[model samples]
Target: MGWLKDDVALITGGGAGLGLALVHRFIDEGASVVVLERDANRADSLKRKFGEKIETVVGDVTSYEDNVKAVETAVERFGRLDTFVANAGVFDFFKPLSEFEGPEISAAFDELLSINVKGGLLGARAALDALIKSKGSMIFTVSNAGFYTGGGGPLYTASKHGLVGVVRQLAHELGPKVRVNGVAPGGMRTSLSGLKATNTADESLETMEGFEELIIGITPLRMSPTPDQYCGPYVLLASRENAAPMTGVVINTDGGLGVRGIMNVCGGEDLSA
Candidate 1:
């Protein structure tokens, strides 16, 4: 049997990208999953692809009611929730702070924070009762941006950092029953839609030159990770037997951003500078 056999998992944004990858991995490991995707089409797609093995919920993570309904649906369908993966998130597409005026920046900050930080927090809260009853775990999808400065612009970085705080705080408060943690992925290609900012995932290679340069130049491994590779850490965290003692842990699946090239003095310059 696989690590998560018979486990019931709730994965937000499971219709695509890292979320989709995690769904496939979890199911292959013999786990049942509920996909909470905002896009109705994506939810339908998951139903088609995974058949009855997966449950699809059309909801937004930012809404408390939606999160509530999602967790409830998971319990109703699977009888219990063994794990909750708060993987629904979007990038701010490096919309530099300088580009936005006072009002624009305020609007942008609110939008990003609402979707990224609030959504994860709501997911955790929604799953609290079920998780405590099952003694389950919560795993969030933080970005390399959560730890470092260059992964994204101001709003995104701030949101991720805030999420790290959420994971740690929840881990501290709900210990011994509900394990809380996060995974900080570096860069991967994915479809992240439904955001006010520019869509980073759908951008072309030529459009991502600056982004690629920023990532590859500093990563010690010098290779961007795939969305699928990042799912392993989540699976490990989700498995009670494997990561029982790990709480408040933030795994860096970010291609070694910790041990990498130097940062420039001129307001933190890039590789070529």
Candidate 2:
């Protein structure tokens, strides 16, 4: 049997990118999923693809009511919620702080943090009662930017860093009942978009030239992973028996970013010798 057999999870931004990958992986592991996606078309596509296996809520994460509705749907449909994955986020395209004008920085910060940070908090709050009853967990989809530099620009970095803090603080506050943790995945090719405030809502990482090469060059693994590859960590974290004592931890699935050498990204280049 799968580790998460019979578990029910509610995930934000489940229409695309890593969120979509998580939805598929969770189902494969025997979990029923409820997705909160802002785009109607993507929501419909998920319904068509998963059919009665998953539920879709076409709503933005930044709205508390929408989050509440998603939680309610999960309980009402699946009978209970075993996990809440806060995975909705936007990128900053590495736009340096100096490149942003006074009002632009403020606008971008507000918009990005609203969805990235505030949305997580709101979703956790909405899922609090159910998680406590089920003794469930909350998994935030952090980024390489959460712990390191240059993963994103100042605004994006700040938002992710703030999320790391949320993971720790919430774990402390919700412990003895509900587990809270995070997974900081490295760069991957996805449709992860940028803030509208920065006029980059239309821009996507998938369209960026040499994006995969850039990630592989810096990562010691010497490879760029797809969204589905990152789902394993989430699966482990969400499994009650597997991750029974794993609260307050943020697993760094960033291809050994912390171990990069001063002279070379990976020191064992000639290991075959």
- Predictions in order: lDDT: 0.84, 0.93
Q: Could you give candidate 2's per-residue lDDT for residues 37-153 as a string of tens digits?
A: 999999999999999889999999999999999999999999999999999999999999899988888889999999999999999999999999999999999999999999999
Q: Which of the numbered candidates is closest to the native, going by highest TM-score?
A: 2
Clashes of each: 0, 0
After superposition of all CA atoms, the RMSD between model 1 and the true structure is 3.9
TM-score of each: 0.90, 0.97
Question: How close to the true structure is residue 171 of candidate 2, measured as C-alpha lDDT?
Answer: 97
Root-mean-square deviation (CA) per prediction = 3.9, 1.5
What is the model-wide C-alpha lDDT for candidate 2?
A: 0.93
